[model samples]
Target chain A: MVALATQTISSMSNTDIEIVVDDPTAPEENSPAVASTRVVDIVVSLLLLALAVTLGWDNWRTGASWDSTGPQPGYFPFYLSVILGGASLYGLGAAFVSRREATETFVTRAQLRRVLAVFVPTLLFCLATQYLGLYVASFLLIAGFMRLVGKIALWKSVLTAFVFTAVMFVTFDIVFDVIMPKGPLEAALGR
Target chain B: MEAFGLLLHGFAVLLTGKTLLLMMVGLVLGIFVGVLPGLGGPNGVAILLPLTFTMDPTSAIVMLSCIYWGALFGGAITSILFNIPGEAWSVATTFDGYPMAQQGRAAEALTAAFTSSFIGSLVAVLLITFLAPMISTFALKFGPPEFFAVYLLTFCSFVGLGREAKHKTVISMSLGLLLAGVGMDTVSGQLRMTFGSAELLRGINFLVAVIGLFGISEILLTMEERLALRGHAAGISLRVVLSVWKDLPKYWVTLLRSSVIGCWLGITPGGAIAASFMGYNLAKRFSKDQESFGKGRIEGVFAPETAAHASGTSALLPMLALGIPGSGTAAILLGGLMVWGLNPGPLLFVEHKDFVWGLIASMYLGNVVGLVLVLTTVPIFASILRVPFAAVAPMIVVSCAIGAYAIQNAMFDIWLMLGFGVVGYVFKKIGIPLAPFTLALVLGNRAEDAFRLSMIGSGGDMKVFWSNGLVGTITTLAILLLFWPVIDKALTSVTRMVRPAKA
Candidate 1:
């Protein structure tokens, strides 16, 4: 069993309590998928603060001042970085003190699963494109999604994905004449 | 007389056979996008923009702008028939428009909504026609200081006037600016923030960022919500339209008031969302029959729809004249403008008269075409709302990926897009505002350039922003807007003490 992290907090308007949870998505029972808003706010602000520091330090190294020709490259950006750092610190402070600190789920578990359901396949599709090319990659992606997420039959998924990919091939390849990435299979056919 | 002649020539340029077909196609496409869930005005436009890359700027802008008009019309259809707002501005439309539909007044509601949209957009177009030249003319005289003042004003106004927390706005804008600095600094030619990656040298493409932020993130957000719509069925006929037309004259005051509010908000960075709410509340507050508002008052529908369309149309004015986009969709349009190698601003009026005038002409024609098209296709679109979101999500994802890849035809951008999609999702989850980020991403370099130019011109003295009266007043106004919350709190507290028994 996956260890679940659960918290409850008031909403943006303090009207109702929302459950914030982090649990693996299980089709069998309810999956606590949403990350806590407080967690997200603090983490994002920290990342922003980190970015501000990096940018500011970089500016300092590259002459963040005025010259005879004009201001140096980092002149304006240095100030912007300082502002970013300040704001990020403020955001960090406010996130802890926020009204819905514990309960506000940035994204629910089911939502996370759904997003991952799309995101993971897209990543795979991008990887597949390098080897198999756009048409094959897209067909596999669409079919995989339909079967996995849509819960459609394999044949239906393949057929629908095939048709969609075919239309795209014609529209982009034959008519628009835009070049698409191709693989050995596409090269097996005549140009 | 000069403006009249230019408009006539604009119509002449716009009425070409190819442009007419393009407008119709764009309208159909826009309505389809609007009817679909998980894709919004800004998202749809940004996703569709790259496909028009090969077209002339005039034709491209005309088609894109028409799509914008059609989306405005389509938003009301979803609101009235499905009780779902297709765009943020359409949220207010559901208050009465949905109620009217529930009362079996769906056709009447939709007709009134579409017609009011037409009127509102027409009014905005007229305003643009008369006012754009003057505004552009004024802007033509702007130097680096004045330009920087305006840019600062825009940034500060968003931070001040926007409902988001000030810290979040600052963080979002700063992040955007930092992201913008990742490319080759055109002025110094010194590459910073490339992280030793060759792809990073080109900077993040606005089109790619927008597609990921709006399109991919929208999918993620919707997958969480899984919106289900049970649409109201209504007769799509001329009789219903005529009945609505007959009812429309009575709410003329509402229409006018909402249009004015919309035009005002749209020209500013307040956007259509704010305009619609303001229009609805003001109409409610001032109406003789305020009691009937949420209970299916036709004026309720009239107020929001008119304001939404008016603001949607007028938002383009600032983009055209000052090169500052006032809304998300307009920001996407500004990105499109930049991609097309057409520099938007005061010089556009002088340099690209045909493009400017033709776009204006299309606004008039597009609204008319959009109104008629949406009015007749109500039942078709209403039925489309029933299509399960599961079937649509994959296609959107695919489209977004294709758009991202197509921008540079590089795998790296796709990776960047995926990264930004996650970033977008995280931002949404954290309640960090995306508008300031988007605007800052698009305009960050320009603002920086103007600031540096001002500094150079004035030997690094920040006083250059306040050198001229125009720049000084604008800069002061920007400062006030940025601190408006604090000032407003202070004044209101004093007022509370002065009139303790008022509440």
Candidate 2:
């Protein structure tokens, strides 16, 4: 994606015109079917508004009542929700009226791939921790990442992960005497 | 005599076998991480902080402070050899240091930078040891108003003094403040922006944010670029290193000037980058052979190296004495102090004298170790640039994730780490200054809490802040800082108008 952007920028630099002309070679950069900035702004604003209303309503029902001495549990949060909703609406209006050209979108397809590469594994690690315990889950996570992302050999990845997790276990569990969460794997091991 | 006695006692603690061993380990680790491109001082310290969690406060600080020194020394190695600065402060060094290296003067440039860094850090450490107590005593005069003013000054200086556009810096700072407003409100115990998520109740940890922004984001950026792999073929000799001393006297004036600029900027929260840039420009302007500066002038390399180390070291003074961190690394150190259950204000010296003094003593010892270690291992560390990005990038990500999780042993923080990683990537893409944002995030909640407490103590009378002389002085300085750009522009125009007429 960066290569494409760089190519487009370099080609544009070589042009004689003062204004930016569409480069024929870069299809994505020159595409005319892209979503309008106003449409995105409105959709994001509405989603935020729904979130604010839901949270504010839930707090009003479940949160602590106000006392004369000070604020209630939901006092500060409820107000913040309102402000967030209001600001989002303001953004929506600004996007609607602004005559400036639509800027580039933040989350392109390439950017999404980058985000998912880290995010998916992290999600799996969190779920795996409950069943395998912190140490085991972290070991597997590290080994898998080393093999998959780092492209290391199987034995090397396994060895590195084992050493890393073992050192952490020794330091935190034995030395610090902090209790780690024991899951089914530890229970089955009976130690 | 009393200060000398206390320092001796501090040394007594620092010289113990356990403390010395940990300090040495930290120094080596710091140098290793600092020499690696994109993994500078803050990331190095954050990655290693969890290791010291079980140790006593004094020993932990000794290790961490040594790590800080080692990282400062390590940054110069890559700057001189590879033309890739390990830290932003080392950017100036690449102007001349890399040129010298290309000309087969790599050993001399490395030696000059190492010795100058040693001298600069030594001066700053000496100042901290003697002057910290006095600074702490004076800092007792500050209330919330003064602290608020200082925080404002810190933000403004980054905006005003930075090379980036002011609007972008302000946006980053506001984003940080918004992030800081998450979690429960201190006064009311009311959640602010948690959105009913239990993890958000505790707020985002500063370490997690820093690791994600500086560490993980850097790795991702490295992955995007097709970096040229440079081979390490040259070896530095002791004789060539020793020859740097011959040119030392010629650059002593630049060294002194850079050191002063470093200390002043370091104290005021302007940080190492500002000090180094200013020092580099000043040295170039004053040099007899200005044309040779960017090509391969020894003085060009010496000035920034001295100022960067000096400023980086002196930033600790405000952090230790006043609970005010003057740079990103110092902010991480402040977070470390908090994790060790030690508050960093005026009373830290009184209540935790051994820890404070021991840390100060370790700074001196660590500088010596850092200089010797980095000078000896420059060739080996420069080889790190030859390693494939794919192999190292994932390791960086894993280290940062683990570091974040270790902070609270919570899986939720790992997610926050990823979120911050995305924020960092966006900030970089949009040309926003991440340093100011990180600085504000570190100081925001503390500033808010102080402000609230002060107002409550003063019976909600805002006049109380202005009535206090010290607070008033700081507040005035902050106001002046806000208008500094306008003032500077007007002054420059007047000087230009007057000079032409006089001529």
Candidate 3:
């Protein structure tokens, strides 16, 4: 039993080690990594603050007053806006205070590059669904993501993307009977 | 006799072909996810929750809970085999488990850990079966104030017991509460945080946030460093498993003790991690060969595994009896209960006896199935490590995208998932605990609802939480937990100062 337990634990550990090794943290802080992380934090915090302010302004302009009802529709949300705004401000403060001392940042350029590569394509895919319809846009989106982010060979990327899109289309549309958005492009293609 | 009859009815439901099939399926999928590093039990359940929408509620929950058990069992496999823990709870196992593997006694350690996990889960299940109804009956007297106090207690205990900095945990929890304030106020259909976008009206789905935090973030983190997939050369044999039975008797006492510790910790909010840590410490102190613990002692592997499994299973008890989830996974199960149109409160057992009993019965069946499935597949799961990271990374990402998209079939969820991925990455960078964030998100809405309802009932007076006897007791507990850290820190500092003076 002891040997069996040892073997089981060892096998599991080996797999975990391989996974952990991929992004093993350095025992000592690296200056470049630290600077990169701090910059990302500052930028993201600012973006969030801008979003909160814009949303708060929009809600204020709308005829929907927060006090219309016993508690207005915006009553709870107004508080959230303030809280989010506060959190972003705090994040900004931390970033600024830490910036003076050339401390290590968490976000590296490489990390940002990787994040944007996938994030941008995904955003575009969502937008495309509005114009190109679900199937056509999905195919294009997947193909684009594969080619750009995955760096697969053109043919392989196209084939894989197309196959996945087709399967999803069939599964959701045919099997599940859920209607998907079809854009002018899809209509023209007779899809 | 009445309880026995109900259990029989439960057995009848569990014995059905559908329930049995789902139990097996859940176990297999759970083991697969659990064996993978970066995918812990909660993540595994969240990733697979979408698949259950098409099934009956009882069957779906059975499968999900079974998957949870399987994941727990599967976690130790990697920890022992390669010194890698698939989950944080399994970290202790790697200390001694991997060393035992290095000594070529891998099969012995695997069997013992697996058996101990089984024993722990089974013990907890039995306790739940007998104790749940009694607790629910006692809880039936609670009103909104009591419920709110319970939530406060939960929050306080989690903060008090948390390993992370208290300030960070509070911040994360407050963020969750702030997010919960986004959707429409339940009492008065007024929109709270929509700003102007129609999409914001629904607020952020807990499932989406979870997928983003645990799944997408995991993918991004993996991309930072190039992971190598190395396979183990040795295979576990049945003969080896059986031969270790003789030594098992020596560890039986430790297993029982750890199981008790696991149960106690699991019952308390934020106790799972503490329970495992306590079990490990106790085991080390009690062992004769304590010096060999971190090096390769079998007791090291045995203690934590037993405690983790026990705590994980016991968390379900409070969820069933009190309508309060003890962990993120239980919170999801609570969502499942709501989707099934069954409210999980004191009335759950009385009003939906069949559902409650059937679920209990399924736990019994599912645990056995999980143990058998995980033990047999140890070698097969270990081989997955041989797959190249280049291939595995993309697959994981695709699965994450699919899981996110499946939640509400809304394009916005995918975007939300990406945003969460970014948050997850930042949290990782800052060394913030993701567990608290996830837990806060799961419990935040319920806490807000209880708080608002309690205040409304009391005419907006905060004193309501302390007015009733039951509520007062709970409030006192919450207050104590809230200030525990200050007391502990002061004591620790005083001790430090006094030690030198005494010397």
Q: What order do you get sorting by TM-score, best first?
A: 1, 3, 2
Better of 1 and 2 by lDDT: 1
Q: Which sections of candidate 3 miss by over 4 Å? A: A1-31, A34-191, B231-234, B491-503
For B1-503, candidate 2 gives per-residue lDDT tens digits of 56677888888988888888998899988887887765889988887787788789999888888888888888887787767788889999999988987787777788888898988888788888888899898877777777776676677777667666555565566556556667887776667667788988898788889888887677555443334434222455678776787768877899999988888889877889988988899999998888999898888888998898889999999888888888889988898998988988888988998988888888888888777777666655555554434345445665676677778988777677776776676567545678877877777677766665566566666675676777777667776776778889999999999999999
User: For model 1, how does the per-residue alpha-carbon lDDT over B1-503 read when each residue is reduced to its tens digit?
Assistant: 67778888999999989999999988987888887777878888887786677788999998888778777787887888778798889999999998988787877888888898998999999999999999999999999899889988999998999887889988888888878877788799987777678998889888899898989888777666535445445655788788888877788899999999999999988889999999999999998778888999888898998998899999999999999998889988999888789997889999999999999989989888888788766666555554435456666776787778777778788778878888898888777889989999999889888888888889878888889899999999999999999999999999989896775
- CA lDDT of each prediction against the hidden true structure: 0.82, 0.72, 0.72
Assess the local accuracy of residue A1 in candidate 3 as a C-alpha lDDT between 0 and 100. 3
Off-target runs (Cα >4 Å) in candidate 2 are A1-155, A163-191, B487-503
> Which ranges of candidate 1 are over 4 A from the true structure?
A1-34, A153-156, B496-503
Instruction: List the candidate numbers ranked by DockQ, top first.
Output: 1, 3, 2
Best by DockQ: 1
Tens digits of per-residue lDDT for model 1, A51-82 = 89988888877768877898888877788899
Error of 2 at B381 (Å): 2.2
Q: Chain A alone, TM-score for each of the models? A: 0.75, 0.66, 0.59
What pairs collide in candidate 2?
A: none
Better of 2 and 3 by lDDT: 2
